[model samples]
Target: MSAYYDLYETPSPKGREGKKSLHARVCPIKTYTQDEFIKHVAAFQLLPKNQIAGALTAIIDDLCDLLADGYTVEMGDLGFFSTSLKCLQETDDENDKIRAESVTFQNVHLRVSSKFRKRIKHAMKFERVHSLTRKQKKITSTVEERKKRLVSFLKIDICITRKEYIRLTGLTPYEAMKELNDFISQGVLRRRGAGRSVVYVAGENLKVE
Candidate 1:
Protein backbone atom coordinates (compact mmCIF):
# COMPACT_ATOMS: atom_id res chain seq x y z
CA MET A 1 0.00 0.00 0.00
CA SER A 2 1.18 3.52 -0.73
CA ALA A 3 2.13 5.68 2.26
CA TYR A 4 4.53 8.51 3.00
CA TYR A 5 8.11 7.45 3.62
CA ASP A 6 10.80 9.47 5.36
CA LEU A 7 13.84 7.41 4.54
CA TYR A 8 14.05 5.52 1.25
CA GLU A 9 15.77 2.20 1.09
CA THR A 10 19.21 1.91 -0.47
CA PRO A 11 19.63 -0.73 -3.13
CA SER A 12 20.22 -4.13 -1.61
CA PRO A 13 22.98 -6.23 -3.13
CA LYS A 14 21.31 -9.51 -2.38
CA GLY A 15 18.87 -10.12 -5.13
CA ARG A 16 15.92 -11.84 -5.99
CA GLU A 17 16.95 -9.39 -8.71
CA GLY A 18 13.85 -7.87 -10.28
CA LYS A 19 11.76 -9.44 -7.51
CA LYS A 20 10.88 -6.06 -6.00
CA SER A 21 12.09 -2.46 -5.86
CA LEU A 22 14.62 -2.00 -3.06
CA HIS A 23 13.10 1.28 -1.91
CA ALA A 24 10.94 1.24 1.21
CA ARG A 25 9.32 3.98 3.21
CA VAL A 26 11.33 3.98 6.40
CA CYS A 27 10.32 7.45 7.55
CA PRO A 28 8.68 10.24 5.60
CA ILE A 29 9.56 13.91 6.00
CA LYS A 30 8.19 16.81 3.98
CA THR A 31 8.05 20.58 4.14
CA TYR A 32 5.18 22.37 2.50
CA THR A 33 5.70 25.42 0.36
CA GLN A 34 3.06 28.06 -0.41
CA ASP A 35 1.96 26.33 -3.60
CA GLU A 36 1.73 23.00 -1.84
CA PHE A 37 -0.27 24.58 0.94
CA ILE A 38 -2.71 25.99 -1.60
CA LYS A 39 -3.04 22.65 -3.34
CA HIS A 40 -3.59 20.89 -0.03
CA VAL A 41 -6.33 23.33 0.94
CA ALA A 42 -7.94 22.98 -2.44
CA ALA A 43 -8.21 19.26 -1.82
CA PHE A 44 -10.25 19.74 1.33
CA GLN A 45 -13.91 18.73 1.50
CA LEU A 46 -15.96 20.67 -0.99
CA LEU A 47 -16.26 24.20 0.27
CA PRO A 48 -16.94 27.43 -1.64
CA LYS A 49 -13.69 28.60 -3.20
CA ASN A 50 -13.70 31.92 -1.36
CA GLN A 51 -14.45 30.30 1.94
CA ILE A 52 -11.78 27.66 1.50
CA ALA A 53 -9.17 30.21 0.53
CA GLY A 54 -10.10 32.44 3.42
CA ALA A 55 -10.03 29.59 5.91
CA LEU A 56 -6.64 28.34 4.83
CA THR A 57 -5.22 31.83 4.74
CA ALA A 58 -6.56 32.49 8.22
CA ILE A 59 -5.09 29.32 9.63
CA ILE A 60 -1.69 30.03 8.15
CA ASP A 61 -1.85 33.61 9.28
CA ASP A 62 -2.84 32.55 12.78
CA LEU A 63 0.09 30.21 13.00
CA CYS A 64 2.45 32.89 11.73
CA ASP A 65 1.10 35.53 14.06
CA LEU A 66 1.21 33.26 17.07
CA LEU A 67 4.80 32.37 16.34
CA ALA A 68 5.71 36.02 15.82
CA ASP A 69 4.20 36.79 19.23
CA GLY A 70 6.23 34.06 20.86
CA TYR A 71 3.26 31.86 21.57
CA THR A 72 3.40 28.13 21.06
CA VAL A 73 0.33 27.34 19.03
CA GLU A 74 -1.05 23.95 19.79
CA MET A 75 -3.27 22.22 17.25
CA GLY A 76 -4.93 19.96 19.79
CA ASP A 77 -4.39 16.34 18.72
CA LEU A 78 -2.25 17.44 15.79
CA GLY A 79 0.79 18.56 17.74
CA PHE A 80 2.57 21.45 19.45
CA PHE A 81 3.82 24.17 17.09
CA SER A 82 6.28 26.90 17.98
CA THR A 83 9.20 29.02 16.85
CA SER A 84 12.71 28.67 18.14
CA LEU A 85 14.61 31.67 19.35
CA LYS A 86 17.55 32.43 17.16
CA CYS A 87 19.10 34.73 19.66
CA LEU A 88 18.28 36.12 23.12
CA GLN A 89 19.19 39.35 24.79
CA GLU A 90 19.57 40.00 28.47
CA THR A 91 18.00 43.06 30.09
CA ASP A 92 20.27 45.23 32.24
CA ASP A 93 17.41 45.80 34.71
CA GLU A 94 17.54 44.46 38.23
CA ASN A 95 15.30 41.63 37.18
CA ASP A 96 17.03 39.02 35.12
CA LYS A 97 15.18 39.17 31.82
CA ILE A 98 15.98 37.33 28.65
CA ARG A 99 13.92 38.10 25.55
CA ALA A 100 13.89 36.29 22.27
CA GLU A 101 15.75 38.60 19.92
CA SER A 102 15.17 36.72 16.72
CA VAL A 103 13.21 33.69 15.75
CA THR A 104 13.72 30.84 13.32
CA PHE A 105 11.33 28.10 12.40
CA GLN A 106 12.70 24.65 12.77
CA ASN A 107 10.10 22.22 11.54
CA VAL A 108 6.45 21.88 12.33
CA HIS A 109 6.04 19.47 15.21
CA LEU A 110 3.30 17.18 14.01
CA ARG A 111 1.75 14.28 15.83
CA VAL A 112 -1.38 13.70 13.79
CA SER A 113 -3.83 11.49 15.59
CA SER A 114 -3.51 7.92 14.40
CA LYS A 115 -6.81 8.09 12.55
CA PHE A 116 -6.11 11.43 10.85
CA ARG A 117 -2.52 10.64 9.97
CA LYS A 118 -3.47 7.33 8.46
CA ARG A 119 -6.23 8.86 6.40
CA ILE A 120 -3.99 11.65 5.17
CA LYS A 121 -1.17 9.27 4.40
CA HIS A 122 -3.39 7.05 2.34
CA ALA A 123 -5.02 9.94 0.53
CA MET A 124 -1.70 11.52 -0.35
CA LYS A 125 -0.55 8.47 -2.21
CA PHE A 126 -1.45 9.82 -5.63
CA GLU A 127 -0.32 13.37 -5.04
CA ARG A 128 2.17 14.77 -7.50
CA VAL A 129 5.82 14.79 -6.50
CA HIS A 130 7.88 17.80 -5.48
CA SER A 131 11.60 18.40 -5.74
CA LEU A 132 13.88 19.91 -3.15
CA THR A 133 15.59 23.20 -3.95
CA ARG A 134 19.31 23.73 -4.34
CA LYS A 135 19.65 25.26 -0.89
CA GLN A 136 17.98 22.22 0.59
CA LYS A 137 20.33 20.07 -1.43
CA LYS A 138 23.32 21.84 0.09
CA ILE A 139 21.98 21.41 3.57
CA THR A 140 21.32 17.75 2.92
CA SER A 141 24.85 17.36 1.62
CA THR A 142 26.27 18.88 4.79
CA VAL A 143 24.26 16.52 6.95
CA GLU A 144 25.19 13.51 4.87
CA GLU A 145 28.81 14.55 5.10
CA ARG A 146 28.56 14.51 8.83
CA LYS A 147 26.91 11.11 8.79
CA LYS A 148 29.61 9.78 6.49
CA ARG A 149 32.34 11.05 8.80
CA LEU A 150 30.69 9.31 11.69
CA VAL A 151 30.48 6.14 9.63
CA SER A 152 34.12 6.40 8.62
CA PHE A 153 35.44 6.95 12.14
CA LEU A 154 33.31 4.03 13.03
CA LYS A 155 35.22 2.45 10.10
CA ILE A 156 32.18 1.52 8.06
CA ASP A 157 33.82 0.98 4.69
CA ILE A 158 31.95 -1.41 2.48
CA CYS A 159 33.43 -4.73 1.08
CA ILE A 160 33.61 -5.88 4.69
CA THR A 161 31.18 -8.66 5.47
CA ARG A 162 28.11 -7.32 7.20
CA LYS A 163 28.90 -9.07 10.45
CA GLU A 164 32.46 -7.80 10.48
CA TYR A 165 31.35 -4.24 9.61
CA ILE A 166 28.87 -4.25 12.46
CA ARG A 167 31.42 -5.58 14.90
CA LEU A 168 33.95 -2.90 13.99
CA THR A 169 31.62 0.12 13.58
CA GLY A 170 30.25 -0.18 17.13
CA LEU A 171 26.80 0.40 15.66
CA THR A 172 24.09 -2.01 16.49
CA PRO A 173 23.84 -4.35 13.54
CA TYR A 174 20.84 -2.42 12.24
CA GLU A 175 22.47 1.03 12.48
CA ALA A 176 25.72 -0.11 10.91
CA MET A 177 23.63 -1.74 8.27
CA LYS A 178 21.72 1.50 7.69
CA GLU A 179 24.84 3.67 7.38
CA LEU A 180 26.32 1.33 4.84
CA ASN A 181 23.07 1.28 2.95
CA ASP A 182 22.84 5.08 2.88
CA PHE A 183 26.37 5.32 1.59
CA ILE A 184 25.32 3.05 -1.21
CA SER A 185 22.36 5.22 -2.16
CA GLN A 186 24.42 8.41 -2.07
CA GLY A 187 26.99 6.67 -4.27
CA VAL A 188 29.52 6.87 -1.47
CA LEU A 189 29.59 3.15 -0.89
CA ARG A 190 28.42 0.04 -2.66
CA ARG A 191 26.51 -2.99 -1.43
CA ARG A 192 26.16 -6.45 -2.91
CA GLY A 193 22.96 -7.88 -1.50
CA ALA A 194 20.88 -8.84 1.51
CA GLY A 195 21.40 -11.13 4.51
CA ARG A 196 24.65 -13.02 5.04
CA SER A 197 25.93 -12.52 1.52
CA VAL A 198 25.74 -8.69 1.77
CA VAL A 199 29.05 -6.95 1.17
CA TYR A 200 29.86 -3.28 2.00
CA VAL A 201 32.77 -1.29 0.66
CA ALA A 202 33.71 2.40 0.73
CA GLY A 203 33.13 4.01 -2.66
CA GLU A 204 35.20 7.14 -2.03
CA ASN A 205 36.75 9.30 0.66
CA LEU A 206 34.60 12.14 1.87
CA LYS A 207 35.90 14.79 4.26
CA VAL A 208 33.32 13.86 6.84
CA GLU A 209 34.67 10.33 6.76
Candidate 2:
Protein backbone atom coordinates (compact mmCIF):
# COMPACT_ATOMS: atom_id res chain seq x y z
CA MET A 1 0.00 0.00 0.00
CA SER A 2 1.17 3.50 -0.82
CA ALA A 3 0.13 7.06 -0.05
CA TYR A 4 -1.71 8.63 -2.98
CA TYR A 5 -1.88 12.23 -4.23
CA ASP A 6 -4.04 14.14 -6.68
CA LEU A 7 -2.59 16.71 -9.02
CA TYR A 8 -4.39 20.07 -9.01
CA GLU A 9 -3.70 23.17 -11.04
CA THR A 10 -3.18 26.22 -8.84
CA PRO A 11 -2.57 29.80 -9.87
CA SER A 12 1.15 30.44 -9.92
CA PRO A 13 2.01 33.00 -7.26
CA LYS A 14 4.66 34.60 -9.45
CA GLY A 15 3.15 33.81 -12.83
CA ARG A 16 1.85 36.44 -15.24
CA GLU A 17 -1.74 36.66 -16.48
CA GLY A 18 -3.42 33.19 -16.68
CA LYS A 19 -0.39 31.08 -15.83
CA LYS A 20 -1.05 28.08 -13.50
CA SER A 21 1.00 25.19 -12.15
CA LEU A 22 0.15 21.65 -11.17
CA HIS A 23 0.54 20.88 -7.48
CA ALA A 24 0.34 17.46 -5.86
CA ARG A 25 -1.83 17.24 -2.76
CA VAL A 26 -2.26 14.11 -0.65
CA CYS A 27 -5.54 12.28 -1.26
CA PRO A 28 -6.70 10.10 1.57
CA ILE A 29 -7.65 6.55 0.57
CA LYS A 30 -9.67 6.02 3.69
CA THR A 31 -10.20 7.60 7.10
CA TYR A 32 -9.60 5.57 10.25
CA THR A 33 -11.63 6.71 13.23
CA GLN A 34 -10.50 6.45 16.89
CA ASP A 35 -12.74 3.41 17.46
CA GLU A 36 -11.19 1.63 14.48
CA PHE A 37 -7.70 2.55 15.68
CA ILE A 38 -8.45 1.18 19.15
CA LYS A 39 -9.78 -2.04 17.65
CA HIS A 40 -6.62 -2.45 15.58
CA VAL A 41 -4.44 -1.90 18.66
CA ALA A 42 -6.53 -4.38 20.66
CA ALA A 43 -6.12 -7.00 17.94
CA PHE A 44 -2.34 -6.58 17.85
CA GLN A 45 -1.91 -6.49 21.65
CA LEU A 46 -4.34 -9.39 22.31
CA LEU A 47 -6.47 -7.16 24.59
CA PRO A 48 -10.19 -6.39 24.60
CA LYS A 49 -11.40 -3.39 22.59
CA ASN A 50 -12.96 -1.71 25.62
CA GLN A 51 -9.75 -1.95 27.66
CA ILE A 52 -7.62 -0.61 24.83
CA ALA A 53 -10.07 2.25 24.19
CA GLY A 54 -10.19 3.17 27.89
CA ALA A 55 -6.39 3.17 28.14
CA LEU A 56 -6.04 5.37 25.05
CA THR A 57 -8.69 7.77 26.42
CA ALA A 58 -6.86 7.95 29.78
CA ILE A 59 -3.57 8.68 28.04
CA ILE A 60 -5.18 11.53 26.06
CA ASP A 61 -6.78 13.00 29.18
CA ASP A 62 -3.52 12.85 31.14
CA LEU A 63 -1.56 14.28 28.22
CA CYS A 64 -3.95 17.25 27.97
CA ASP A 65 -3.77 17.82 31.73
CA LEU A 66 0.02 17.77 31.73
CA LEU A 67 0.23 20.10 28.73
CA ALA A 68 -2.22 22.50 30.36
CA ASP A 69 -0.06 22.53 33.51
CA GLY A 70 2.94 23.73 31.44
CA TYR A 71 4.76 20.41 31.33
CA THR A 72 6.31 18.87 28.21
CA VAL A 73 5.27 15.23 27.75
CA GLU A 74 7.81 12.84 26.22
CA MET A 75 6.31 9.64 24.80
CA GLY A 76 9.70 8.11 23.93
CA ASP A 77 9.27 6.90 20.36
CA LEU A 78 6.21 9.10 19.71
CA GLY A 79 7.74 12.50 20.61
CA PHE A 80 7.14 15.47 22.88
CA PHE A 81 4.05 17.68 23.36
CA SER A 82 4.32 21.29 24.55
CA THR A 83 2.16 24.35 24.69
CA SER A 84 2.77 27.69 22.96
CA LEU A 85 1.41 31.21 23.42
CA LYS A 86 0.95 34.56 21.69
CA CYS A 87 1.41 37.75 23.66
CA LEU A 88 0.70 41.42 23.14
CA GLN A 89 3.70 43.70 22.66
CA GLU A 90 5.07 45.32 25.79
CA THR A 91 6.15 48.94 25.83
CA ASP A 92 9.87 49.70 26.29
CA ASP A 93 9.06 52.30 28.95
CA GLU A 94 10.26 51.21 32.45
CA ASN A 95 6.96 52.30 34.00
CA ASP A 96 4.85 50.29 31.53
CA LYS A 97 2.75 47.47 32.99
CA ILE A 98 2.27 43.93 31.58
CA ARG A 99 -0.45 41.82 33.15
CA ALA A 100 -1.51 38.15 32.83
CA GLU A 101 -4.22 39.19 30.35
CA SER A 102 -1.55 40.42 27.95
CA VAL A 103 -0.52 36.85 27.17
CA THR A 104 -2.72 34.61 25.01
CA PHE A 105 -2.01 30.88 24.87
CA GLN A 106 -2.00 29.07 21.53
CA ASN A 107 -1.90 25.50 20.25
CA VAL A 108 0.05 22.46 21.47
CA HIS A 109 3.09 21.75 19.30
CA LEU A 110 4.45 18.25 18.75
CA ARG A 111 8.06 17.32 17.98
CA VAL A 112 8.23 13.86 16.45
CA SER A 113 10.95 11.62 17.88
CA SER A 114 13.68 10.41 15.51
CA LYS A 115 12.76 6.81 16.19
CA PHE A 116 9.12 7.31 15.12
CA ARG A 117 10.14 9.52 12.14
CA LYS A 118 12.60 6.89 10.87
CA ARG A 119 10.07 4.08 11.30
CA ILE A 120 7.41 5.94 9.27
CA LYS A 121 9.89 7.18 6.67
CA HIS A 122 11.08 3.61 6.03
CA ALA A 123 7.49 2.48 5.26
CA MET A 124 6.40 5.51 3.24
CA LYS A 125 5.59 5.36 -0.49
CA PHE A 126 3.67 7.73 -2.72
CA GLU A 127 1.59 7.33 -5.88
CA ARG A 128 -0.42 9.65 -8.10
CA VAL A 129 -4.18 8.95 -7.97
CA HIS A 130 -5.67 11.51 -10.35
CA SER A 131 -5.12 14.83 -12.08
CA LEU A 132 -7.42 17.79 -11.47
CA THR A 133 -7.63 21.34 -12.80
CA ARG A 134 -8.43 24.50 -10.87
CA LYS A 135 -11.19 25.28 -13.37
CA GLN A 136 -13.94 23.77 -11.23
CA LYS A 137 -17.09 25.86 -10.89
CA LYS A 138 -17.76 27.54 -7.57
CA ILE A 139 -20.81 26.21 -5.71
CA THR A 140 -21.15 28.84 -3.01
CA SER A 141 -24.38 30.86 -3.14
CA THR A 142 -24.38 34.65 -2.88
CA VAL A 143 -24.64 36.21 0.59
CA GLU A 144 -28.02 37.76 -0.25
CA GLU A 145 -29.27 34.39 -1.48
CA ARG A 146 -28.00 32.66 1.65
CA LYS A 147 -29.53 35.30 3.92
CA LYS A 148 -32.88 35.10 2.13
CA ARG A 149 -32.90 31.31 2.29
CA LEU A 150 -31.91 31.32 5.96
CA VAL A 151 -34.61 33.81 6.82
CA SER A 152 -37.16 31.77 4.83
CA PHE A 153 -36.06 28.64 6.70
CA LEU A 154 -36.31 30.47 10.01
CA LYS A 155 -39.95 31.16 9.27
CA ILE A 156 -40.60 27.41 9.00
CA ASP A 157 -37.90 25.92 11.26
CA ILE A 158 -36.52 27.07 14.61
CA CYS A 159 -32.84 26.65 13.67
CA ILE A 160 -30.41 25.31 11.04
CA THR A 161 -27.33 23.09 11.10
CA ARG A 162 -24.11 23.36 9.12
CA LYS A 163 -25.17 20.25 7.23
CA GLU A 164 -28.55 21.79 6.46
CA TYR A 165 -26.93 24.91 5.07
CA ILE A 166 -24.71 22.76 2.85
CA ARG A 167 -27.74 20.90 1.51
CA LEU A 168 -29.80 24.00 0.95
CA THR A 169 -27.10 26.13 -0.69
CA GLY A 170 -25.10 23.42 -2.52
CA LEU A 171 -21.93 24.65 -0.83
CA THR A 172 -19.03 22.59 0.52
CA PRO A 173 -18.69 22.19 4.29
CA TYR A 174 -15.85 24.74 4.46
CA GLU A 175 -17.77 27.30 2.41
CA ALA A 176 -20.95 26.65 4.41
CA MET A 177 -19.11 27.21 7.67
CA LYS A 178 -17.56 30.47 6.41
CA GLU A 179 -20.95 31.81 5.31
CA LEU A 180 -22.58 30.81 8.59
CA ASN A 181 -19.80 32.40 10.65
CA ASP A 182 -20.03 35.55 8.52
CA PHE A 183 -23.73 35.70 9.26
CA ILE A 184 -23.02 35.27 12.98
CA SER A 185 -20.40 38.03 12.96
CA GLN A 186 -22.68 40.38 11.03
CA GLY A 187 -25.46 39.88 13.63
CA VAL A 188 -27.77 38.30 11.05
CA LEU A 189 -27.80 35.00 12.93
CA ARG A 190 -27.01 33.76 16.42
CA ARG A 191 -25.48 30.42 17.29
CA ARG A 192 -27.12 28.15 19.89
CA GLY A 193 -25.41 25.35 21.82
CA ALA A 194 -22.05 23.94 20.67
CA GLY A 195 -20.46 21.03 18.78
CA ARG A 196 -22.84 18.54 17.14
CA SER A 197 -25.86 20.11 18.83
CA VAL A 198 -25.04 23.60 17.54
CA VAL A 199 -27.69 25.39 15.47
CA TYR A 200 -28.28 28.85 14.07
CA VAL A 201 -31.18 31.14 14.81
CA ALA A 202 -32.09 34.54 13.41
CA GLY A 203 -30.65 37.47 15.34
CA GLU A 204 -32.98 39.65 17.42
CA ASN A 205 -32.76 42.57 14.96
CA LEU A 206 -32.90 40.48 11.75
CA LYS A 207 -35.66 41.47 9.29
CA VAL A 208 -37.33 38.65 7.38
CA GLU A 209 -38.55 38.86 3.78
Candidate 3:
Protein backbone atom coordinates (compact mmCIF):
# COMPACT_ATOMS: atom_id res chain seq x y z
CA MET A 1 0.00 0.00 0.00
CA SER A 2 1.17 3.53 -0.74
CA ALA A 3 2.10 5.65 2.27
CA TYR A 4 -0.43 8.45 2.62
CA TYR A 5 0.47 12.05 3.43
CA ASP A 6 -1.15 15.46 3.81
CA LEU A 7 0.11 18.99 3.34
CA TYR A 8 0.22 21.75 5.94
CA GLU A 9 1.62 25.25 6.00
CA THR A 10 4.14 26.62 8.45
CA PRO A 11 5.57 30.08 8.84
CA SER A 12 8.70 30.70 6.82
CA PRO A 13 11.91 30.94 8.85
CA LYS A 14 13.62 34.12 10.18
CA GLY A 15 14.00 36.67 7.42
CA ARG A 16 11.01 35.48 5.37
CA GLU A 17 8.62 37.15 7.81
CA GLY A 18 4.87 36.76 7.19
CA LYS A 19 5.48 34.16 4.48
CA LYS A 20 4.10 30.65 4.72
CA SER A 21 5.57 27.45 3.29
CA LEU A 22 3.90 24.13 2.70
CA HIS A 23 5.25 20.87 4.02
CA ALA A 24 4.04 17.27 3.77
CA ARG A 25 3.48 14.94 6.70
CA VAL A 26 2.55 11.30 6.81
CA CYS A 27 -1.05 10.34 7.56
CA PRO A 28 -0.94 6.86 8.96
CA ILE A 29 -4.12 4.85 8.39
CA LYS A 30 -3.27 1.73 10.32
CA THR A 31 -0.98 0.50 13.07
CA TYR A 32 0.58 -2.94 13.09
CA THR A 33 0.56 -4.68 16.46
CA GLN A 34 3.21 -6.68 18.26
CA ASP A 35 1.27 -9.84 17.41
CA GLU A 36 1.75 -9.15 13.71
CA PHE A 37 5.46 -8.58 14.12
CA ILE A 38 5.93 -11.72 16.19
CA LYS A 39 4.01 -13.76 13.64
CA HIS A 40 6.11 -12.47 10.75
CA VAL A 41 9.41 -13.10 12.54
CA ALA A 42 8.30 -16.53 13.71
CA ALA A 43 7.40 -17.54 10.17
CA PHE A 44 10.61 -16.16 8.74
CA GLN A 45 12.88 -17.80 11.34
CA LEU A 46 10.87 -21.04 11.60
CA LEU A 47 10.41 -20.52 15.31
CA PRO A 48 7.41 -20.77 17.60
CA LYS A 49 5.61 -17.52 18.36
CA ASN A 50 5.91 -18.06 22.09
CA GLN A 51 9.63 -18.72 21.80
CA ILE A 52 10.16 -15.65 19.65
CA ALA A 53 8.13 -13.54 22.05
CA GLY A 54 10.08 -14.77 25.06
CA ALA A 55 13.38 -14.00 23.40
CA LEU A 56 12.10 -10.64 22.22
CA THR A 57 11.10 -9.75 25.76
CA ALA A 58 14.53 -10.66 27.10
CA ILE A 59 16.22 -8.66 24.32
CA ILE A 60 14.12 -5.59 25.12
CA ASP A 61 14.91 -5.90 28.82
CA ASP A 62 18.62 -6.05 28.08
CA LEU A 63 18.40 -3.17 25.63
CA CYS A 64 16.78 -1.03 28.31
CA ASP A 65 19.47 -1.89 30.85
CA LEU A 66 22.35 -1.42 28.42
CA LEU A 67 21.02 1.89 27.09
CA ALA A 68 20.55 3.08 30.68
CA ASP A 69 24.20 2.28 31.37
CA GLY A 70 25.26 4.66 28.57
CA TYR A 71 26.30 2.00 26.10
CA THR A 72 25.98 2.45 22.34
CA VAL A 73 24.51 -0.80 21.06
CA GLU A 74 25.37 -1.60 17.46
CA MET A 75 22.79 -3.85 15.78
CA GLY A 76 24.52 -4.72 12.51
CA ASP A 77 22.79 -3.06 9.55
CA LEU A 78 19.63 -2.03 11.40
CA GLY A 79 20.97 0.75 13.62
CA PHE A 80 22.83 1.84 16.73
CA PHE A 81 21.12 2.90 19.95
CA SER A 82 22.32 5.74 22.20
CA THR A 83 20.97 8.41 24.49
CA SER A 84 20.33 12.09 23.78
CA LEU A 85 20.17 15.03 26.15
CA LYS A 86 18.71 18.52 26.25
CA CYS A 87 18.73 21.40 28.66
CA LEU A 88 15.58 22.12 30.66
CA GLN A 89 15.94 25.70 29.54
CA GLU A 90 18.46 27.45 27.31
CA THR A 91 21.28 29.50 28.85
CA ASP A 92 20.60 33.22 28.95
CA ASP A 93 23.21 33.84 26.24
CA GLU A 94 25.79 31.04 26.55
CA ASN A 95 27.18 33.07 29.47
CA ASP A 96 24.43 31.93 31.87
CA LYS A 97 25.05 29.05 34.24
CA ILE A 98 23.83 25.62 33.08
CA ARG A 99 24.89 22.76 35.24
CA ALA A 100 24.64 19.00 34.73
CA GLU A 101 21.62 18.96 37.04
CA SER A 102 19.83 21.35 34.68
CA VAL A 103 20.25 18.94 31.73
CA THR A 104 18.13 15.83 31.13
CA PHE A 105 17.88 13.05 28.62
CA GLN A 106 15.37 13.74 25.88
CA ASN A 107 15.15 10.12 24.82
CA VAL A 108 17.11 7.27 23.31
CA HIS A 109 18.33 7.96 19.79
CA LEU A 110 18.45 5.38 16.99
CA ARG A 111 20.79 6.12 14.14
CA VAL A 112 19.68 3.80 11.38
CA SER A 113 22.41 2.16 9.35
CA SER A 114 22.85 3.09 5.69
CA LYS A 115 21.47 -0.29 4.61
CA PHE A 116 18.35 0.22 6.71
CA ARG A 117 17.73 3.69 5.33
CA LYS A 118 18.25 2.55 1.75
CA ARG A 119 15.77 -0.30 2.15
CA ILE A 120 12.91 1.98 3.22
CA LYS A 121 13.93 4.88 1.00
CA HIS A 122 13.78 2.66 -2.08
CA ALA A 123 10.46 1.00 -1.19
CA MET A 124 8.33 3.94 -0.07
CA LYS A 125 5.45 5.09 -2.26
CA PHE A 126 3.40 8.13 -1.36
CA GLU A 127 -0.17 9.29 -1.97
CA ARG A 128 -1.73 12.50 -0.79
CA VAL A 129 -4.75 12.37 1.54
CA HIS A 130 -7.00 15.06 2.92
CA SER A 131 -5.57 16.98 5.82
CA LEU A 132 -7.27 17.52 9.15
CA THR A 133 -6.58 20.38 11.49
CA ARG A 134 -4.38 19.60 14.50
CA LYS A 135 -7.24 20.63 16.78
CA GLN A 136 -9.66 18.36 14.93
CA LYS A 137 -7.41 15.33 15.27
CA LYS A 138 -6.55 16.10 18.90
CA ILE A 139 -10.16 16.47 20.13
CA THR A 140 -11.71 13.14 19.19
CA SER A 141 -12.82 11.77 22.60
CA THR A 142 -13.74 13.15 26.01
CA VAL A 143 -11.66 12.42 29.11
CA GLU A 144 -14.12 9.87 30.47
CA GLU A 145 -14.47 8.23 27.08
CA ARG A 146 -10.69 7.88 26.74
CA LYS A 147 -10.40 6.40 30.22
CA LYS A 148 -13.18 3.91 29.51
CA ARG A 149 -11.73 2.85 26.17
CA LEU A 150 -8.27 2.41 27.63
CA VAL A 151 -9.48 0.32 30.54
CA SER A 152 -11.49 -1.85 28.17
CA PHE A 153 -8.48 -2.33 25.86
CA LEU A 154 -6.20 -3.36 28.73
CA LYS A 155 -8.73 -6.01 29.68
CA ILE A 156 -7.88 -7.94 26.48
CA ASP A 157 -4.37 -6.65 25.69
CA ILE A 158 -1.33 -7.11 27.89
CA CYS A 159 0.04 -3.55 27.75
CA ILE A 160 0.06 -0.31 25.77
CA THR A 161 2.69 2.16 24.59
CA ARG A 162 2.26 5.91 24.42
CA LYS A 163 1.91 5.64 20.62
CA GLU A 164 -0.84 3.04 20.94
CA TYR A 165 -2.70 5.17 23.46
CA ILE A 166 -2.52 8.18 21.14
CA ARG A 167 -3.87 6.10 18.25
CA LEU A 168 -6.62 4.53 20.37
CA THR A 169 -7.78 7.81 21.89
CA GLY A 170 -6.90 10.36 19.12
CA LEU A 171 -5.12 12.56 21.64
CA THR A 172 -2.23 14.90 20.98
CA PRO A 173 1.12 13.53 22.18
CA TYR A 174 1.39 15.95 25.09
CA GLU A 175 -2.23 15.43 26.15
CA ALA A 176 -1.96 11.65 25.94
CA MET A 177 1.30 11.56 27.90
CA LYS A 178 -0.10 13.80 30.61
CA GLU A 179 -3.21 11.64 31.00
CA LEU A 180 -1.12 8.45 31.05
CA ASN A 181 1.12 9.86 33.79
CA ASP A 182 -1.99 10.92 35.70
CA PHE A 183 -3.42 7.41 35.37
CA ILE A 184 -0.17 5.99 36.74
CA SER A 185 -0.34 8.44 39.63
CA GLN A 186 -3.92 7.37 40.37
CA GLY A 187 -3.00 3.64 40.25
CA VAL A 188 -5.07 3.01 37.14
CA LEU A 189 -1.98 2.12 35.09
CA ARG A 190 1.70 1.49 35.68
CA ARG A 191 4.72 2.35 33.57
CA ARG A 192 7.35 -0.15 32.53
CA GLY A 193 10.93 0.45 31.35
CA ALA A 194 12.62 3.81 30.96
CA GLY A 195 13.18 6.36 28.20
CA ARG A 196 12.34 4.95 24.74
CA SER A 197 11.52 1.51 26.11
CA VAL A 198 8.48 2.59 28.11
CA VAL A 199 5.05 0.96 28.09
CA TYR A 200 1.99 0.98 30.34
CA VAL A 201 0.09 -1.88 31.83
CA ALA A 202 -2.94 -2.20 34.11
CA GLY A 203 -2.31 -1.21 37.69
CA GLU A 204 -4.04 -1.85 41.00
CA ASN A 205 -6.88 0.50 40.03
CA LEU A 206 -7.33 -0.89 36.53
CA LYS A 207 -11.03 -1.20 37.08
CA VAL A 208 -11.05 2.57 37.64
CA GLU A 209 -13.25 2.43 40.72
Q: Highest TM-score: give the candidate number.
A: 2
Top-down TM-score ranking:
2, 3, 1
Tens digits of per-residue lDDT for model 1, 1-209: 12223333367576546544434343323345665556545555444556766877899899988877778777766766766544344445757654444434455454456766776666654212122211221222344554545466546443566556545545433444555656655776655554346665556653323
Candidate 2, residues 56-146, lDDT tens digits: the string is 8899999999998899999879999999987687577868777789978789999999999999889777755442333444655677887
Provide the lDDT at 41 for model 3. 76
| Per-model tally of clashing residue pairs | 15, 0, 0
lDDT of 1 at 184: 59
Which window of 10 residues has the lowest lDDT sum in candidate 3? 129-138
Give one digit per residue, the lDDT tens place, for model 3 in 1-209.
35657789876776777657799998764445788679767766789999988988998899999998889999789899999888998756877888889888789889999999999999887766564455444375687888899988887777899879978987655556668877876888887765467889989987732
TM-score (C-alpha, index-matched) for candidate 1: 0.34
lDDT of each: 0.53, 0.76, 0.78
After superposition, candidate 1 runs with Cα above 4 Å error: 1-23, 26-44, 86-108, 111-115, 118-209
Please tell me which predicted candidate would have the highest lDDT against the true structure.
3
The residue ranges of model 2 lying beyond 4 angstroms of the native Cα positions read 15-22, 88-95, 131-209
Better of 1 and 3 by lDDT: 3
Model 2 scores what on Cα lDDT? 0.76
